[model samples]
Target: MDQRQDILAQWAADQIEQLYQHSIPAQMVTVSGDASFRRYFRIIYSENGVHKHWIAVDAPPEHENSRQFVDIANVWSNAGVKVPSVLAFDEAQGFMLLEDFGDVLLHPELTADAADGLYKSSIDSLIELQQIARTDNIPAYDRKLLDCEMALFSDWLCEKHLGLMLSCDEKLMLNQVFETLANSALAQPQVMVHRDYHSRNLMVCKANPPLHDKDFIGIIDFQDAVYGPLTYDLVSLLKDCYIQWPREQVLAWLAYFKAKSAQITDINEDQLVRDFDLMGMQRHLKAAGIFARLSIRDGKHGYLNDVPRTCEYIMQTARIYPEFAAFTEWLESVFLPALNKEKMA
Candidate 1:
C-alpha cells in the first residue's frame, strides 16, 4: 500500500479491534463516492479460516455526523428496506464497519436493455420505502426544510456561483413558483423518502433474495432520508442525475408506480402528476445549485459539466407552467448560456 492507503488501513484495523475486540488482519480497498463529505473502504478479513468482507465508512467527525448514519441505517433496516447491516460503530472516531453489498452501482444497469426489469424492481423498492415513511414513528416532513432547499437555487446558483442577482420581478416570480410547488408537495401523503434515491446509491445484490443475491436491491447513502412527499424519491430515481430515460419510458414507470402505490395507499393520478413535476423541479434546482457549489466551494470542477443538463431539466419543467414564465426565461437567457460556455471551455 502507498502512504495514504497504508495510513487508512492501519487506522481502520486499530478502530475495528477496539470496537469488536476481534483481531483479524484488515485490507482496505478504496470505494467510490459522490459529492459528499463521507468516504468508504472495503475491509476484508479472515477469522477461523473463514473469510469475510465488511464495508468501513470513514466520515471524518468534523465533516459528517456518524451518529446520524447509525440511526438512519437502523431505521431503514428495521423497516424492511435493504440497507447495509451495521456490524459495529464508533461514533467518537466516526468509523463504522458495515456489511459490504459489493461495488456495482445501478447506473450501468439502467443504461442496458435490462433496465426495464431493474427499473420495475427499483420502483418496488421505492414503494417499500414510502410505506416505511408512512408509519407514525417517523417525523412529518415540514415546510421549513422544503423552503430552505428551494432557496439554495437563489442563494448559490443564481448569486454566489453564477455571479448574477435576481431582479425584483424575477425574485417575486421565483417565490411564486416555489409557493405553488411547495403547496402541492405539502398536500401529498407523507412517506419515508430517501432524499438522494437514484441509480448510484442502489446496488444489485443477486446473492440475497428476489432471485440471486442479485435480485436483492441494496440501499446506501441514505443518511438524509426524511418524511416527505410520496413522489420525492420516485422522481429522484426516474429523473436520475447520472442517467436519463426516454419520456415514454419515464411515463410508463410513473404509471406503473401509480398503479402499485394505489394498491397499498391512496393517491390520485392528477395529484401524482403534480407531485412528480413539483418534486422534480425542487430536486433539479437543488442539484444545479449543488453542482455549482461543488465547483466553487469544493473545487471539484468535474461537476460543472453536469450544470447544462440540470439547467435544461429545470427550464423544460418551468416552461410547462405559466406561473414560472419569468424564471424560465431568466434561466434560458442567463444560466443556460453561461453554463454552456463553461462546458465548452
Candidate 2:
C-alpha cells in the first residue's frame, strides 16, 4: 500500500474505534473510483456481534474539498434526500468515513424493462433535491462558469487531444455558440443541481416493486451541487454519456420530469424542450471536454471511450436549433471526422 492509503487506513481504524469503543476494522479493500482524484475503500468489522461496513474516502486536501462534501451531504440529507451519511471527516487530511451503500449503482440496473421504474425513483429524488432551499455554500451556475466549462471542448478536446487548431472564423463561431448555450442556461429557473446526477453516481438499494421508495436512493459524488438550470440534471440523466436512450423515450421522460418539477419550475413544453436541448448542448460540451482532460492530464484514458457518445449528444442537439446551425455544420464537416481519424490512428 502507498503511504497515503496507509495513513487513511490507520485514520479510519482509529475513528471506528472511537465510534464503537475499540471496534477494530479489517483491512480496507479498494473500491471503484470515478473520473475525479478521490479514492474509495470498503472496511468491514464486527461491532456488537454484527458486521458493520463503512466507505473510507481519500479526497486529498489539495485536489478536493472534503468540507464542502460533508456540508452538502448534511444539507441534502436533512432535506429528506437519501445521501450517504457522513459519519466523520478530517478536513485537513481530506479523509472521510461514509455510510456504505453496497455495490449497486443505478447504471447497470437500468434495463430496458426497468428503466421507467428506476428513473421514476431517480426523478423523484432529483425533484426533492431541487426543492432544497439555496444556502450560501451553494454556488450559482453563472455565465462565467458556464462559458468556462464549454470552452473545454475547444481547448482540451479540440486543441489538446485532437490537435485541431481552429481558424479565426471557426474560433469566432464556436464562441458565439458557447454564448448562446450559456444564455439559454441563464434564462432557465435556477434550482439545486447535482452537477453529476447521472446513473453512475446513484446507488440502487432494494430495487424491487416499490419504485417510489425514498430510501431506495443512494446518491454519491454530489460535492459539486450547484444552483443551476432546472433542465441540466434531467438532460444528464436522459442523455447519459455512458448510455443512450431512444429520442422518443427521452422526450417521454422529459415530459415526466416537466410534470414532476412543475411546482418548483414553471415552463411550457416548447420552452422546456428548447431549454433542455440547449442546456444539453452546454453539458455535453463540458462533459466531452472533461473526459478529454481526464485522459490527457490525469492519465485516465478509459474516459476517452465515452467522448464519442458525449459528442453525439452535442451533434443531436445542434441539429435541433437553427442558431446552432453553423456549429452543427462545423461539427459534422470538421470535428467528427477529426475525432474518427484520431480514433483510427
Q: What lDDT does each candidate get? A: 0.78, 0.89
- Write one digit per residue (lDDT tens) for candidate 1, span 154-227: 88888887667778877887888788878888887777888998988999875854323445778898877778
Candidate 1 regions off by >4 Å?
1-23, 46-50, 133-140, 208-214, 262-266
**Where is the poorest 10-residue window by lDDT in model 1?**
206-215
What local lDDT score does residue 86 receive in model 2, on the 0 to 100 scale?
Answer: 92
Q: Residue by residue across 1-345, what tens digits does model 2's lDDT show? A: 799999999999899888966667447999977788899999988656876678999999999988999999998888888888898899999999998888999999999899999988889888898889999999999999999999999999999999999999999999999898898899888889999989999899753323235348778999998999988999888889989999989999888887877544557789988988899999999999999999999999999999999999999988988888899899999999999999998
Model 1, CA-based lDDT? 0.78
Identify the candidate with maximal TM-score: 2
194, model 1: CA deviation in Å? Answer: 0.9
